[model samples]
Target: FHDFLSVLLCGHKIQAKLSSNDKKLLPFLASYLCAVAPEFKPFITFTEDTLKNFDAVIATGSNNTATYFDHYFSKYPHIIRKNRNAVAIITGKETPKQMQSLADDVYRYFGLGCRNVSKIYIPQQYNLDHFFNGMYAWKQVINNHKYINNYDYNKAVYLMSDIKLFDNEFMLLKEDTGYSSPISVVFYERYKDINDVKAQLEDQKQNIQCIVSLEDVPFGVAQTPALSDYADGVDTIDFLIKL
Candidate 1:
């Protein structure tokens, strides 16, 4: 809801369709919207036929939904579809203070946003104590959630079954073969040379969004994103303008 409001404030007329489960929150949210921006009366229901009336469509969803959007909306002149994603930073010389600040990027919004850092690429010799200590603040939040409980339970079951996966409160399960988004998880690879690391990152470039690294390069920043940042392999305005 806040995300939509942010975009709408930027001069966009958003036509939102809430999932059936989210319908209960619509009336309250609508009332709030009316108070803030009376011109924006968001609709609650939608049908397939109604979608054709739009000049352009911007669909934000999972890889499955991206596939569906591609099949159904590709015939249209303008369509922008995005897959789920997140961001992470790599720091070889991270101090305790830096790690603490980095925790904000990882745990904010329950690590749900596409820009959240789901994985960190750190040197093999990095101190785990500093990283975990920084993230300790999230323990209570993770314990109070039902979804995190399910993930932890499933993680334990997988461990008992000798299934290899990552495990933690905020994130777990790495080495996944396909698209990984949300639910923070880190995958590590050892490199003997800088060229090897560069080659590996280049190979996975298509699947990557922001790369947080200490290396001085054109897109390698500490923990911030520019306004022009693109996500999930698509441009935001390009997608919106097409629609």
Candidate 2:
């Protein structure tokens, strides 16, 4: 990490967005990096105005936020923007053990991270009982969280409001024709044929990060991502250097 910072500070200034809620962590993180390599001390800024003066820009945010960022940084010479997304994949021969392992990918961090599994495209004849049985353990932990409770309440209110919206409180609602982040809603079309599933996955290739399943599809991993993974088709160092 210190070596990377040394490379970044060679001729570049670092402008970062620090959430108001996370102000405390920022100083500690910055100080730690500087301790390892004192050269990084002069390159840090924590304001948006400072961000605009940079040679390039990088922004991490939800899909909604990424849209706004594109509009805001349109005139910049270079930019990298990340949007919200999650992983899902089709599998036909998953065993009980595999199903349990996949459940960790689904429920970890309460389905918040982009690497988390938000959807599963299983076959039409797939045994949902074993899948749900593996996931049953997470129900209590999910119920205990206050935000999930609020999400459940908000979904219920929307359902009863007579508004024209899809509402499936028992499972997450999926009608946006895109990904949903930080929630447990999955949207998938069941397929009888593997070729059809392959075609659908190919069509959504640009939108996906990781595809986890029992089948050994090309470039598919079982779960999670490595540190070297380039998110949203953008290189991390290339983003920073342009700025």
Candidate 3:
């Protein structure tokens, strides 16, 4: 949000869609922008009312919330974003540095961003040592108070149950088929054929934000996205330019 807002502060943006909670710092950020430029706030509105007072919209939310946005904003020229996660297709041959770099995609933003690598696709009977070694640099993240709380909670739940998990004293790895993993927990799956997995991912392109591999995108570069890297592959500038 800050990225787009900062760009618009050059005195050209018109409107934005924000929730009620998004305006908490409106006074501060807006005041700061006003100090930076005199005519900046005229084109901005921080309202939560559902009124058709804008030319277009960009709505982002979870998959569940996207249903409501699609229905309510169906008449508007809008881009509704749903829950999407990034994945890493590991071939079990990455160097130690590459593995450690991959850890950035997982631990960055505390595994909360859509670009975070929540699920990793590995080959059948893949070695786990390399995966563990790559994430060693971020092992210190476990010391965070909030992170350790979640870690302890998930570890206890998996322990009392019979779920087989791999624990390296910080993050927990579970062999699951799901893409969205909880904090301190990452889900992984085994794939025998890379082409088959690619086909499956292609079929569900709308459900994914990005795919990270050595050949595709370098590790640790997910969060530091380029301006052209539009979310959901919908060109925001193109839409506005057409408008």
Give the winner by lDDT. Answer: 3
What would the per-residue lDDT of candidate 2 be over residues 112-231, giving only the tens digit for each residue? 666676766657776567667656555665466665675686566656875343333334534344565335555555568878766876787666666676543221242445545666
Q: Which ten residues in a row have the lowest lDDT in candidate 1?
A: 214-223
In candidate 3, where is summed lDDT lowest over 10 consecutive residues?
Answer: 2-11
Assess candidate 1 and give its lDDT.
0.55
Whole-model alpha-carbon lDDT for candidate 3: 0.82
Better of 1 and 3 by lDDT: 3
lDDT of 3 by residue, 74-163 (tens): 888878889999988998778899899999999998998999999899999899889999999999998899999999999999999989
Can you rank all candidates by TM-score, best first? 3, 2, 1
Predicted candidate 1 versus true structure: per-residue lDDT over 150-191, tens digit per residue:
567767766788867645456563543333533544444433
Error of 2 at 33 (Å): 2.1
**Model 2 residue 4 CA deviation in Å:** 8.9
Clashing pairs in 1: 56-243, 90-212, 166-173
Clash count for candidate 3 is 0
Candidate 2 worst ten-residue window by lDDT? 215-224
Better of 2 and 3 by TM-score: 3
lDDT scores of the candidates, listed in order: 0.55, 0.59, 0.82
lDDT of 2 at 130: 64
Specify the highest-TM-score model's number.
3
TM-score computed on alpha carbons, candidate 3: 0.88
